[model samples]
Target: MEILDPQNTVLTNAEVYNIVVEKKKAFSSAPKDHRASPALRTVIYETLTYLSGSPAATQTEEQIKSLIRALSPYKFTGAEILQLINLRPKTAVEVQLVIEECEERLTEEQVNEIVEIVKQNFPIQSETKNSLEAAEG
Candidate 1:
C-alpha cells in the first residue's frame, strides 16, 4: 500500500464511508459460496474498513494486507494498484499532475467545469462552526 500524505488529501470521513459502502455492495454481489465463509467475509470487511481510514484494532498494514492476500488469493496488478491509489486524496501539486495526465482523456474545459461545480457546492464547513457561532453570541 502507498503512504498518502495527510496534508495533501482532501478526503473527508464521509467519502471514506461511501467507499466502504460500495465495497460492501460489491462483496455482497459475489457468489453465495464465496460469501458464506465467515473468516473470508471478516477479512474482506476489515480490509475495506482499514483502507477507508478506520483505525486498525490490532493488525498493522502488512498484517492486514497479508491476511487479505492469503484469504482472497486475488493478486492486484500494478494497474489495479495505480487505479486504487488514484482514488485516494492527493496534495494540490499531485492533483494538478493528475489533472494534466488525464487532460487528454478529459478536456480542460470539462475539468474546470467540474472544479467550479464542486467549489460552488462544497463550501468548507468546520466541525465546530455551529458551536463557535453560538458561543460568540
Candidate 2:
C-alpha cells in the first residue's frame, strides 16, 4: 500500500469509539447476510464493548476540545495532552505518570492544579454505559 500522510495522527479513545459506533450503525442498516463480514461485525462489537466502559463513552467532541484548550498552557506535546484527556487522571501521581519530567518541570501547586482541573472539569458520565449493546446485537 502506498503511504498516505507520512506524519502519524493520534486519536483519543472517544474518537475511536465514535468511529466504531458509526461503522456499526452502517453495518446494521445494510441488507441481511450482506452485513459487514462476521469478523468485522465482531470487531465492532468488541470495540464498542471495551470503549463503553472508558471515559470515552460519555465524552463529547466539544469536551475534548475544551480539555485540550484548558491544558495548552502547560505546554505538553499533542501525545501527552491526548493521554491526559483520554485517561482523565484524578490525582497528582496519575498526572505525574502522564507528563514527562514532572518533578523538574512542574511545581507542587501546578501539579495540584492539573489534578484538580482533570478531576473537577471532566466528569465521567455513567449514563451511556451499555446503551449501544442491544442495538448492535
Per-residue error (Å), model 2, residue 67 = 1.0
TM-score against truth, every candidate: 0.27, 0.83
**lDDT of candidate 2 at residue 13, scale 0 to 100:** 88
Q: Write the per-residue lDDT of candidate 1 for residues 5-85, one digit (tens) a residue.
A: 846654433445454466578778888765536875686577666644432222234433443343232243444323323
Structure candidate 2, residue pairs in collision:
none
What is the lDDT, from 0 to 100, of the residue 70 in candidate 2?
Answer: 82
Q: After superposition, which runs of candidate 1 have C-alpha atoms over 4 Å from their true positions? A: 1-35, 51-92, 102-116, 119-137
lDDT of 2 by residue, 69-124 (tens): 88889999887888888898888999999999999989999999998777665764
RMSD of each: 16.0, 5.2
lDDT winner among the candidates? 2
Relative to the true structure, how large is the alpha-carbon lDDT of every model? Answer: 0.43, 0.81
Q: Model 2, poorest ten-residue lDDT window? A: 1-10
